[model samples]
Target chain A: MEYIIISTGFALALLGLWGILSQKNLIKIILGFTIFNTGINIVMVSIGYVRGKAAPILDVIKPSEAADKIVDPLPQALVLTAIVIGLGVTALMLVYALNLHREKNSLDINSFKDLKW
Target chain B: MIKKILIIGLLAGVGLIFFDLFNAYQGSEVLGKTGRYYAENGADEVGAANLVTAVIVTYRGLDTLGEVTILFLTAAIISFVLKFRREDFIPNRPVRITSELLDSASQVIVPVIFMVGIYIFINGHLTPGGGFQGGAVIASGVLLMIMANPNFGISHKVIAKVESISGIAFVLIGIMGIFLAGGFLDNRLLGLGNLGELFSAGVIPIIYTFIGLKVGAELSNILGTISHAQNEKN
Candidate 1:
């Protein structure tokens, strides 16, 4: 079941990548990038999962009893970090998009080609 | 069209092979063994039940520092890209608007969001959330305000001061770790006190808080600069 969910996330990510490659609108590209980023983070977090486990916090409960079941907390932490970094990048990209809009008066990427050979 | 289809088919075939190879080696204990090592030893050395946080803030403190530096650099680059000299830039015609409903909504919600961000950052060491996550949340709150009031702008000077102070404090705390604990960003500098306590991670929470503040300010500043530039261009 976990693997199924993870594969679904990966498929979504691939779809997003396809959108990014094929889309003409800059905003669509940015949205695609976001989709891709979220999918990857979900995959990373899922990789650290242990079945039927609670979070890795101490007692509150007995350690010896719960040791066999606690889910790894490390990937959760790493994914949190990744999410923040993704936000920063997305925000930066939005700023760039605004700049592009100002310069070109349009949000279409194909229309703003200045460096084409 | 035919060429595109052929290329995609080739790629799919290659992907299938890779998938098969991965499945063939699946359920092996190679990486799982390493995880088990940390799962066993992490509780003792870090004093935190969450091995992830222990690894992130303590074992990989240097990586965190570097990541913070990257954020700082990004802010710098963004500010540079959108910078306007006082004399050369012309302010665009201001768009007048009146929206009492929007203003009232923002006024009510912004403080709550800000509080939540602070709570997240402060309790990061103890809980799943941390400074980076909280900082971004705070920035989103600021973004909410920005969206609600087009005329309202963050004071550039105040933001600059906040960013610089927080950035400097983050580094200073790291240096304190070095001086006091004999290593840069050493979380054990202040003594890892009783486990699961707020201040137990030594300087980890402190550093994360500073990082949170810095990241929040920088993110807002980036958004502010872009909007300001757009207003100018218009």
Candidate 2:
């Protein structure tokens, strides 16, 4: 089950990378970035999941029992922060894309050849 | 042709990385030292029923501070980049009559979403949801309202005020932690009541509430600015 989840994450990441490398439209590239972010999050999450373990909440189990029953909380915490940061980065990228479009009247990566020395 | 080969090579590299990760990941059936320590000590120390909440709010409080600032700065940068152009400030959008059904439906939905968002943040110390998730939900409500009725807009001043106040409160709570407890963002400033109750987690829920409100305000501000910019173009 872990293998399946992890593999899916890797596949998603590769697909995103392909989208980013192949697509000329800035929007597609941004979408690729979001996909990449999701993939990384999924990998992080799946890596932390143990067999038949619960979330690391203290609501159910006693503190002593937590070590046996709970999945790793560190990865979950990191992913949570990463997810929020990813959204911010995505929003910023989209805004930059919008500004680029406004300036050049084009969304194609090839349109701005001046950047390609 | 070269692009195809390059893409394939990249895919092979990615596959190798994943394979390496898979091999390297030795699945632990039990918590490691850090996890075990938190598991054993967190409830008693942080007074939060939810351990994840304890970890985020108390254990790694400084990181959360930096995270919120990143969010705050993103909103600021977004708004700064989209500063008003006088000609476009009036929003030269063509008058498309909004349907009554859509408007009324949103009127019903927005409040419910807002309430749920508040609940998530308020119960951060007891449940799975927290400030970030709750704040995103609330921002989505604002987004729904904006979409349903183009004219139904929130002022930048209102959002800015909410954000500023909440952000100040969050920092003040952290400062209070510094003075009242062992270190910064310590949840032990107030008495740790019974673990499962609403008021049990000393200052975690409060801090999360502040975070939720601040995040919601900032996101709503960013979204509103972006949408207005879109409207200006059309």
Top candidate, metric DockQ: 2
Quote the lDDT for B182 in model 2.
80
> Top model by lDDT, which number?
2
Q: Residue-wise lDDT of candidate 1 within B72-171, one digit each (tens)?
A: 7777778787766676455543666648887788899999999999988887777777778888899989988887776567998888798788778877
Indicate the residue-level lDDT of B86 in model 2: 75
Cα error, residue A79 of model 1, in Å, equals 2.8
- Tens digit per residue, CA lDDT, model 2, B1-234: 998899889878987887788778765677777877877888788888788888888899888999999999999999889776776665446658778897898999999999999999999988899999999999999999888866566798889889999989988888988888887888888888998899988888889999999999989988888887776642
| Location of the lowest summed lDDT over 10 successive residues in candidate 2 chain B | B86-95
lDDT of 2 at B149: 68
Q: Deviation in angstroms for A106 in model 1?
A: 1.8
DockQ values of all predictions: 0.39, 0.67
Clashes of each: 0, 0
